[model samples]
Structures are given as structure tokens and as C-alpha cells.
Target: MGQKIIRFSDLTGTHVENDDDLVRIVVRQHPDLEDGPVEIEALGGELTAVEELALDLVTIELHRPGADEPETVVLEAEAFDRLASATPMAEVLRGAKKVACPIPSQTAVPAGAKERVNYASLEHAGRPHKGRTTDAEKQLVRQHLDRINERLAAEGVRTIDLGNAEHVVRYGLEALARERGVTLG
Candidate 1:
């Protein structure tokens, strides 16, 4: 009555970026099995059609027992190559299946929203900073594209064609410095 050998210590590998045949593995579990119960498999193929890009390339951790943290399991690269060609890895981690990792929240932008400006740095700030292009810098780039078309007509958008004057002052000062979050430097 003895079969509790769960030794799968750190064995990392990564090569993902436009999928160069995919490869991303991260394992850890040398001596920490509290609620012990994990399993995974996908030996090389048949990952159910890129199951979300092979579960973004596995990452499992389990160390329960008065746990403060340690119970993560993220595998998809064909269930991490079927638990790396499982042979006796606790019968593919006891038929692994316990995934639920999604904690990312930080979205709050509505107070006069509009922050995302980098039109190639406002097209190099409408060029000509000592690189030649004067007439008082084309009338200060036409008064900064008429103050970004008066803040795009108070954010109603649709007014950026001062007759191609330096591409409408580099996209109307990059849409008035991204709707006013301003930081043209």
C-alpha cells in the first residue's frame, strides 16, 4: 500500500513567439502535497486544436498543508506534452484537472477618458526641431493644429485636416496629446 511519489521539480523550457513549434513548460513539486490530487497529459500532439495556445504553456504548483500559497496548475501545451510523457508520474498526476487562474483587474478610466497617445511620438512632434522648417515653425504648427481642433470639438472626434499642413500637425498633436493626458516628451 504505497504509491505516492510526486516528484516533478523545476524543469523549465520556453520558445514561444509566433509559435516556433511551441514549447513552454514550468514544473515544481518536490515535497509539498497537501490535498494531493493533480493530473495532466498531452504527449506531443492532439491538444484539442491549440487549446488556447496550449494553455499558454503550463505552470503547475501544489503545496497545500496550512498553505499560504501554492496550488496552481496551468498546462495546455498538449497538457504539457502529456505531463512530459508520463510513465508513472502518479498516473498523469492522478488524472489532472483543476484549473482556474484568472485574477487581473485594474480598469478605471472614465473621468474625461482618453489616454493612449503615441502616434509615433506625435510624428516626431511634427518634425523640425532645429532640423529646419521655419516661419516661426509654420506658425507654431498652425497653433498646434488649432489646439487639436479644439479638443476634437470637445471629444466628439472628427476634425483633423488642416489641408495637410505637416499631416495636420502630426495627427492633430496626436489627438491633442491623447485627449489631454498630455505628455508629448
Candidate 2:
């Protein structure tokens, strides 16, 4: 028995806007691979820490004909470090996690009240606010922490009490809005 030596394409400069778009682009480009295999086999994780940077690490395996072997290439979610100064909007929204706000037990939507949409399954348009992963819900938190730390570095505000999940979400959302030049509220 041998471990499957998977061949990966060189995605060195591929710029995927977000996780979902990343998946779509990779699939469309590869044509042979479906979405599930790409996430499970190639990437090695459902979600990665790169999400902290408002980015996703996508592995595209190029199976070029008559080549010695396939090569693995890395694609940043939004920006191409060599050319672009900032990340693309799609990258910022891709695989963005929704900060689950707690709903009161009494106010919780009744079971099967309505068929909810899994925005995660939806495709994003060129415009913002169209995706179900709205700025209010999905905001990159870790990246925001880094930004806040930098701005307050001299002020000695490093000691942040991430007391609760919601607080973290609140902070992350605020930071993302500021960085993207948008308002979550």
C-alpha cells in the first residue's frame, strides 16, 4: 500500500476573492475536480487560519500534459502580493464566518418557521451586500485584532479582554467595517 501522491497545479499567482469563489474558480479551471474533493483532498482542511487574514489558501493542482509531474501552486484570496496592493472584495467575503448572535430562547425562530437560505451555498456578485454572508454576520475577526493592536500599539491597549464570543464578534465586525470602509450597523 502507498499513500496517494496527489499532483497539484501551480496556483502561485491565482487570486481568489473569497473561499467560495476560490472553490468555484478552481473547479472551473480544473474541470475534472468537483468542489468536495478540492476542499478535502487538496487543501487539507475545511477552513484554515488564513481566514484570519481575510484570506483563504487555495491549492490548485496543474496537470499539464507531457510534464514530468504536476505542480502545486498557492493563490491568495484577494490580492496578488506581486501586483496588487489590497485584497479583492470577493476574497474578503469568501468563507467569512458569521458571528452567531445569541437569540433569546423565547424569541428564537420556531422550528421550520421558514426554509432558511444557506448563503454559504450562494454565489457572490460583483457588488457587495448581495451575498447572504452580509457584513453584519460574517466579518474577519483575527485580522481586525491585528489592526487594532497596531493602531493602539503605542497606547498600551494590547491587553484586550475577549470576555465573550459576542464581544469578539463585535470587535471583529467593527474592525472589518473600518478596514473595508463600510458600516455593519
Best lDDT goes to which candidate? 1
What TM-score, to 2 decimals, does candidate 2 have?
0.19
Query: Which tens-of-lDDT digit does each residue in 1-185 have in candidate 1?
Result: 88853332222222222333333433333333222234433223333366655335667667666543345666665666565563755566678786666555445555898663322232322332323332333334444666645655666665555444455354334443456565443
* Local distance difference test, each candidate: 0.44, 0.40
Question: What C-alpha lDDT does candidate 2 achieve relative to the native structure?
Answer: 0.40
Best-fitting candidate, measured by TM-score? 2
Model 1: lDDT equals 0.44
What TM value does model 1 have? 0.16
- What are the per-residue Cα lDDT tens digits for candidate 2 across 1-185? 87944344234334333444332222333434322334322222333544665646565556676433345577874343334347655565475576576868855678879543332221211112221233212333333444444544545444222444444453344444455565433
Cα error, residue 78 of model 1, in Å, equals 2.1
Report the C-alpha displacement of residue 129, candidate 1, in angstroms: 53
